[model samples]
Structure formats: structure tokens, C-alpha cells
Target: MHPENTNFIYVNREMRTLSNIDYDITLLDWLRTNLKLKGTKEGCAEGDCGACSVLVHDGSNSEVRPINSCLVRVGQVVGKGVITVEGIGNEKKPHPLQTSFIKENASQCGYCTPGFIISGISLLNSNKDVDENSINDSVSGNLCRCTGYSPIVKALKSVGNNHEEIKPIQFVEQNNDVQLGLVSYHNPINLDELLNLTNKPNFRYLAGGTDLNLQRPIINEDQNTIINLSNIKELKNIEVQNNKLLLGSAVTIENFLVTIKDRIPELIELLQRFGSPQIRNQGTIGGNLCTSSPIGDIAPVFLALNAKLNIFGSNGRKKVNLNEFYTGYRKNILTKDEIVSSIEVPLPKKDYNLFCWKLSKRYDQDISTISLTVYIKIRDQIIDDIHLAAGGIAETPKYLDNLCKDMKGQKLDKSISLAINNIKNYIKPISDIRGTADYRIESFRGLFRRLEKCLVDGVKTMSIMDYNNE
Candidate 1:
């Protein structure tokens, strides 16, 4: 038996002081089975389905965003406030979004209703202006088989247009004390504690657990230790100094978007297509980079940005260029005790043009079949400095070093053709479920052709997928 403590977590203005709870179970299971809150349905155990969506206040920020409970572990919510579907409305009086759903006849089978309502509430809470795309993006993760999304979208518009002041139902107590769990769950307050904990053997560093949760069940091992890096002040810092932005590894993509919204419109457009709102709320830059997936949305962008990483370990700290970060497919040079602390992104010059594209089957919540990033400076139609990077076309996110060097001082049109030819020889993509190798190669050629057309003919910009007939 494990010993108990008075560590508390808030849910819907009511505080639940938990003791000796099982730390291994997911937040969805704990809510549905342990707490008997069955309103939040479960369609898919994975994060793809928004059926398990709930609003969580991280206790540090005033904004409350929706998150999938299926991907969240019970211990991850310590000192956080969670609001489920049950807390949104009562039998006597339903919430505004719930009432709109009823009035708009949005529910046919009603399995995905609660999730839609919760997500819609979050959308309204976060944004004062509502549009069709905004509503669709808000509930993109939710799927309804019986009823189409038209009525649901209409219902969201009705409730989301009202400018209402949104606040968390319960404010979690800000306790700086570390949470020691029955299992080896540790939340280090500072870098020293994190380094000390990492010095021990067989410990996994967990950031947001978006991708780690998917791997935990498959890689079933008796793993007892996880170092939570979300709460460390140093790891969550974002600074702008000397014409560059220094972003802590633990900063969520959502926070990063808000920070660089005005400064980097192109980057905002790219990240908006990264994942669903819920996943972006929880997913961090460090987690994305650490996974090192070939088709990861941010890898090519980081490569194009010429980013640098500040890595920490038991020994000390060291800096590494992002281009040399990945050694192989889904592998990096980090030791077991090393953790990425922060990232340095240089601001692009006014004369430079940065372009990013991702080709996938679905418009939302889909993995990329091919991702490309280009940073080029054109002076009087001659390419000056060109940096090209691509993913899903190599073992890792590859920087086209040879192609970039060859393109320098060449005419812009000739440089594009040269890069296209260089791709045929350099990139050897494998056949995957998302696409065929031949298909990827052809798509990239077409992408380059479109880029050339845009620069030469001054055509309006759209995704490469848009230009393709097939």
C-alpha cells in the first residue's frame, strides 16, 4: 500500500483533495470510472477524437483552453482546475452553447454533443470574434457519424458571438512545493532539481505528454520515473534580446503563436495548421523536436530559422545548431540525462522571403506527407543566401546543404531548377501509409515549380496541395 498526502486538485469550483490515487491511469478513466462523470464520452482512446474534451486552467494562466482527457494523465493535472461537461450545465439550466445546440437541432445521436459544447465554450472564451473557420477549427477533432457538422457549426456561431467574460470556475491554489506521488512522479521547480533528478537512472523527461502518451502503452515497460518540465520557470521563459527570440523548450505552441502573432504572420499560418487547438494548447516545442518525426510540422521551420538549442545535462550546459541536432530517423544526440532547455530563433531580414508548406490528406489534425521550408534572399533576381529544408523525404528532417550552396549567386529561376534537380539525387523517400515515394518526389517538384511561378510571375500564394489537380 502507498502512503497518502493532502495534495489537492480543483474541479468546477469544488476542490478534491486526493490521496494515494493510482498515478498510471489516464485522466479520462479517472473521471469516468473513479469520479463517475460519464458526460464526457469516449469515442477514440487516442487524441484524435475530441469526445473527451474538457477545459483546464493550468493555474498559472488566466486563459482556460480545451484539452483531450484521454491523452492526459491523472498526475499531470495536480494544482490545475478541470471543468468537465457535467460542470458546464445542470438539469435545471443548460449552458448557452448547450441551449444553442438544442435550438439548432445539432444532435442526432448525441454521442459527440458534450465534447462539441465544451470545445465551443473554449472557442468563445478565447476569441471575441467568431467566424465559420474559427468554429470549424474549434471542433475539428470532433466527429459525428449520424449528424453532419452544419447544424453544429451554426449552433456554435449562435453562442460564440456574445462577448462574455470567461473565467475559471475554480482557481487552483498556487503551491510551489513539489508533488511527490505514490509512484515516482516528480515535478522539479528549478533546473538544479531537474538535473539532480535526471542524474538518476531510467527516468523519462515528460513535457506535455501529447506524443509520449501514445508511446507509453506500446512501449510497455515498468517505467517508474518522469521529470515534469512544464512548471520550471526557467524552461517556460520567453525573451527577446539582440534582435532574436529565445523561447524556452516548455512553451506551448499556443503561447508561442500568441507571442509571435504580429511579428510572424507566415509562421502563425504554418502553426495554425500544426494540430487541433487542444493539441497545440498542450504540445510543446521541445516535445515536438525531441520526437524527431520526419514529418513533424515544426522541424523544417526550425531548420529554416537556423535555430540553436540550449541543452542541459548533469555535467553542464551546451549549445547546438538545430541543423545538426538529428542524427538519424527519430533519433538525436541527447544523453539519457540531457534535456533541451531553450531554443534561439534569429529574426529574418526584410529582404529575405520565408515560405513553409505541408502536404497532407486531411485539412485538419493530419500528419504531413511532405513538409518543406525555404528561406531565400533575392537581390536583383539573383539568389543571395538560400536555406532549404524538407521532411518526409529523408531519414530525418534534412537541411539541403549542397543545394543551398549551389543556388547562391545563381539567377532565381535557374536556382529553383537546380534545386529541383538536386532533390531527385539527394532525397530518397520511402513508401509510407501517407504517400508513395514517387508521389512525394513529384509533389516536391510541383512545389518548387509553384514557388518559381510565384516569384517570377507574381502569382498569389496558396498551398501546394491547392495547385495539384490530383
Candidate 2:
């Protein structure tokens, strides 16, 4: 599939290839060993740490964004463009943030400087105005054992007013398919070609590598075949029809946030804590749902919205209700040959008000202890209709139909108290690294308390600081 000169990537705007390398090699390894660019360090191979952060252009029409090089395989970027720390700037002609870092004493251990610089420069080059919040979010994936992050924030602020133009990057022609070692990677540009390939057996769909790549058994193992869904334009569409919002499976979470900013301003705060900027830029909503993780953040909101999933396969296309999609822990109703094509979210009516909240140990880049979404319509100060859904409180994302039924026709305060007292009836969560089963129950109840206070008392900061006081 090299096609004489095509099975290579434009690394740092320079063509680079490893014709004999295996597909199991990570981009971090390839950058350090094969290409001999050791600037991009690898701290956490699981993509938690940003030591391996790099800017990547997917060879699509979009510009470059940050992602973890450790979680990405070389085969996945055959025709894309990658820019390591070295590509951004150097000591002689350093980026503005680089110089400011030294002046602010942002480099003590220096293990994370390159990654921080890379992430900071990406923010500086974007159309967004630089601020403390933006700078903090941009480098949230990075970890510094020293410097305490104070100098880092100050350094980034020093260059916040400066914006520079990045040189154009080049992309190599994409190989339709390639087989290396135990991994067979396929890049299909359209829906028909994708379906034709998945009609066979033992194939896995890859939208974003954020989740799958962390689990080594899921990628390049047991001679597995990967059908990459990112290149298909049909799976990346966003549309509105008949008072419903249609979101394609391959659309990144960052793009989803941008699209819904004006329409659903309520979700903006909850999603800002979705993940680090790198993850939000690469992880997709369909990928989030497909994993069936009990704590996956996006599914609860969809469940509350009465969303429907659009499925396409050899049998043709069909729509399935989101609440009925999950069967059990890490399980769904989709057949092996079928994949989620898109998600349809019904737009709220004039009388309906939606509220969503995520409870995590840390506010950003953390897994939820419990996630809650409440959609309510009030008529004459009585709750006419309400829908409640939550994550991390059960084996699957639980839709609280019984509780919704119980709370209807009740006042807001009465409804909240009744539901908070009855949450344990609907969920039986397991103890895990994030929290205990008992703690999760209380957290979800606390979210209901928060809903009551915010709506009735005009609480500030969403009452996050006074959580236990309730």
C-alpha cells in the first residue's frame, strides 16, 4: 500500500516512513526511536499524562489539534500529519511561551516542558483568545512533578496577548488499506465501502483511539482488523431536521461542544469538564456510547433527551431508542456486523427546561463518580413531565422511569426530596477506584439537592463547594 511514496506521513512537514516497522509500535516510540525525535517523552503509556502530547492534523479539512502520541499507533496516521515539540520551536527560535516559561521558572524537572509548550502553542495559534481558564484546560493533560504549575500558568499568560501564524502542513496520500504485523487497518471514505468491509467477521470499529488504545487487548492483538471510521464524511455530519438535532458518530466531542454552544448553553459547563482538550478534540460521542462504560459522561445526557441512535448495516438503516440500547455492563444490542451511524437528539420545547450535572473527584479530566441529567416541564408551578437519567450508579446508564413517574404532578422541592430519597431503589453501583457504591448513591442524591437549590434558592458555583453541607 505504499504506492511507491504514499504509505508515509508528513511529520513536521517532512515526509517520513518506516516501511518495515510493525503496526503495534506506538507513535511515541516511532518518534523517539525510528524517526529519532526524542523530544516527545512518554510518561503514561495509557494517555493519562501529557508527556507524549503532540499536534496532529487528520488530513481532513480541519486544522491541527492536540492528542496523546502514546495512545496512537503508527498505522493509524499513515497519511496524516504529526508535529512534535521540535516542530513547534527550538531554543534559538523558541515559541513565545517557551521564553516565558524560563522567565517564570516554569521548568524545574523539565520532563513535561516540551508537552506543555506544545499544548500552549496550540492555544496561542488558535482563533480563541488566551485566558487563564483556556491555558489551564489546554495543558490539563500534562503533569509536572515540580514547579507546582504556578510558573507554568504565569508563563502562558505572559504570551497570551501574542498570536502567530503556523506554517502550512502537508499530508501524504492515504492508503486505502494496509496489513502490517497482526493489525489490518482500513480507511474508508464513504458508507458503502465501510459496510462492505464490515460485512465480514472479527472486525472492530475505531472512531477515536482514546478508549480502545488504552486497552492493549483491543488493538493490534490476536490478528485483529480495524475499520477506521474517521475518514468517512457521512459519519461526520451535523444537521437539524423536524425539530431534532442529528449528530454523526465520527464527530469529535470538541466539535459537538462548539455546535451546541448557542443552542444548549446549559450543557457548556458540564462538557468543559468532559476531558482534557486533547481527548475532547479526538474522542467522539458515538465512541463514548459504544464503549458502554457505566461512567461514560455523554450517555446520561442523551438518555434524558430521549435520543435515538441511527444504525446502518447489511440489513439497511434503523433507529433505536437510546434508553433501550444497553443490555448490561459493557454490552449493547448492536450485532457484530452493525455499527452506530449517528445519534438523533430531540430539541426541547419552549416550556421544557434541561439541567445536567457531573460529579467527579476532580473537576476536570476525571471520571465521574456519578452523572445526572434532568429534563423537566413545569405547568402552573407543578411538574407536568420529567425525565431523569444517571451514570456510574449502575451496571449501565440507568434511566429513572419509575422515579420520573413518581415525581410528576409534584412541586419542584417536593419532587426533588422524593427522588433523592428513592435513588437507591433504582441503582446498585459497584465499588471501584473512583468511589464506593455508597458514596455514589449519596453523590447522585446530592445532585438532586443541587437541582433544588439552584432553581429555588439561586445558588452560585452550582453549589459544588457546599456539596456535603446538603
Candidate 3:
């Protein structure tokens, strides 16, 4: 079983770091109970509610992302810095976002204000000129029972209008003197050390902790050892080399969106619909892919794009296609000691046409009932090559290999009919809360038809603007 006592390292306002006593508790409990930082409220003990949102800087310190403190273990914050609501400003001086929120009457019950204000500040830090859509996406995770969304939106807009210059705040140094519950584990700065430590049998590799945090109690008491990758600097890099985009495992969905927005604008729309703003900020692409959820938004897109995954373990490094990464339902090809290091996606050719669509109950914050990703290469009205993938239709995200084989070199009309026929014969989706079996089947056919029409009309159906407005 995991150790009961872990260490806690906290950085203060003056850039002074301090250690806490007793590490058995969670960061949320520590903040509220010990530190008395009541500004960070606990709407839900789980990560679902944004009321506990706080900004945390990864090892790189290039940008900050919002994370839910409730799900984070106190032991995980060692060596890194955390910015809670209290850190935003003091009573003598308030942050522009805070002032705007109050002036706009954004706070109703005031329970969720701190979280929303912190999220708003993070958004402003990332982008000085915030649009309405960005404001909406940033606060989607914060739930206000009073439903006073308009005023909050107005408050954010007011801050953007003023365009105040906000200085960056540095976290205090780590204090090793004070102990918190258990001795905290400082994240390894070197990749070699990280890999060696992670090769141990029971060590759990954690990135965003969106999923793992849900089972924190079980993981804490179980035989699993924890190794947080969030503090590893090497794993947060993003680079483009030889027409392929390489994303480090620690890169969050928020950073990914910023990196690719200019090059692949269509992806921005798809990403905005992924989850609430809080989820996007804390969830990493590596963790999302590793989860191997059939309906995961990034799975089919990766498959359609022919992405590659780089993995590391004691045995050394290996590379494989993202499509072949999954073996079964909720299962992957990764060994116990192996952790994904990075993902590489090849850029599409100039003439290549790609499209993606998701059928869900709600436009945002809903799992896909059926998701489809299509990529096609056409030459003079003839199909050169085609790749298609779907989730929520089978145990795993599957590529239509047989369909591609039959449709290659065929005309668009023939290919469309063959694709529709193949989907009916191949896909075996189960009935679930989001969709019925028949509904999913028919939706697949309709999506295929729409893709064909888009190709024939010479129009691009997917747009970043579409998702921004959603």
C-alpha cells in the first residue's frame, strides 16, 4: 500500500516556500482547514465543480492552467507552485478581473466567484484580448446555481475592455522545515531519474490527474505508488519538425489549443467542445489518449490523422501508431512500467480534405453518442486514398479498413454507397443513455452523406468559428 504520510511544499506570496505537517490530507482540505484560504470554496469534493479551481504552473513555467484543488493530493505539490484565489490580490489592491466582477454584479451567492475570477484571470494572462466566446468557454466548468451567467460574462468583458496590465506573480520558495502529514515527494527534474523511478512495479504515472483524482482515496490506500509527471519539464514541450507536430505528455488541452490554433484552426472548434473550461485547462492529451475511452474526442482525430505515440520505460523507448495503441475496451497496449512520453501527428497534404463531427446530447460538456473522423485524398474526381474512424460504435475507436479498401480509386458516388453499406455491416454499437442503437447507426449514415456532400460541393464544413460560438 502507498505510504500514509507524504510531504507538502507550498510557495508563498513573497516567493518563500514552506513545508506543511501531515501529508495524508488533500490539497483542498489543507487549504481550507490549515491554511484558512476560504476564498477557494469546495462545491464538490470531486473535480467536476469549478468552485475549487486554482492556477498551477507546470515545471516549464511557460503558462499556467487552472486545476481543481479538491482532487489533488497535498503530496503532489512539492517543488511546484500553486496560485489560489488568495494569491490573486490582497485587500489593499484587487486584480482587475476581481474589480470588474464586483462592478458588474457578477457575484450572486458569492460561493463560486473566487473560482470564476481565478479562471478569468488565467484566461486574461493567456490572451490579453478576450472575446465573448473565449469568456464563455473559460467559465463553462464553473456552476452557479443562481445561473447568473450574463453578469459574469459582462464582468469578464469589462476587464477585457479596460486592458489593464497585470504583472506575473512568482511563487515562494519551497520550505523543507515544516512537514505536512507525510513526507512530500519532490518531482524529479531529470528525465532519466523520472524514467528510472517510474519503472518500479507499483508506481502510477500521473499527468493532469483528471481521472486519477476521482479515485484518489483508493489509489492512496491501494498498492499503487504515485509518480506525478506534471512537474517534469521535459514532458511539457511542443515542437514542429519535418511536417509533424510533437506534443509532450504534460501539455494540457488549453496549451494544445493555443499551439495549433494558427496552423489547424478546425481543431480549435473541436477542442472547445471537449469539456468545460476547467477540464480543458487541467486535462492533458496524453492522459486523454491513455484512458482509451471509445468516445474520447481526441481518439478518432488522432486515428484519422495517423498520429504516433512515443513511450518510455526501463526497457527503453518505442514508437507506435495511435490507432494501434488500444487493444480492447478500457485497455491499452502499454505495460505496467511504461508511460507515454509524447504524441506526433503528421501534417495533412495541401489537397487532403479532413472532417470531424460528434453527436452528443448537449453541445458542450457531453460525451459523444457517436463521433466520426474522415480524411480523404482526391485526384481529378477519383478517390486516391481514404481514412475513416469512429467512436461510440464499437468497443474501441475503429478504422474502416475494409471500407477503405473497397472505396480506394472508386468515384465519390460509388465510395459513398460502399462506405454507408460497410458502416451498417461493421459497426456494432450498444444502446446507451446518449443514443439508441438504431439512432447511432442512422446517424453514422447521415454523417457519411454529409461528408460526401461537402467533398462534392468543394466546401469545408468544419470551422474553429463554429466551436467558438458553441
Best by TM-score: 2
**Clash-forming residue pairs, model 1:** none
TM-score, structure 3 vs. true: 0.88
Please provide TM-scores, in order, for all candidate models, with all chains considered together: 0.93, 0.94, 0.88
As for lDDT, the candidate ahead, 1 or 3, is 1
Ranking by lDDT, best first? 2, 1, 3
Residue 391 in candidate 1, Cα distance off native in Å: 0.6
lDDT for each residue of candidate 2 in 165-280, tens digit (9 for 90 to 100): 55546444675576667888889888999878976567888888888887855335577788888888899999989988899999989889988887777777777788887888
Backbone clashes for every candidate come to: 0, 0, 24
Q: lDDT per residue, candidate 1, 270-344, as tens digits?
A: 787788788888899999999989888888988988999999987799999999899888999998888889999
How does each model score on lDDT? 0.81, 0.83, 0.75
| Between candidates 1 and 2, the TM-score winner | 2
Q: In model 2, which runs have C-alpha deviations exceeding 4 angstroms?
A: 1-5, 60-62, 171-175, 217-221, 458-470
**What TM-score does candidate 2 get on C-alpha atoms?**
0.94
Q: Which window of ten consecutive residues has the lowest lDDT sum in model 1?
A: 174-183
| Per-residue lDDT of model 3, residues 131-157, tens digit only | 888888888777887847999998888
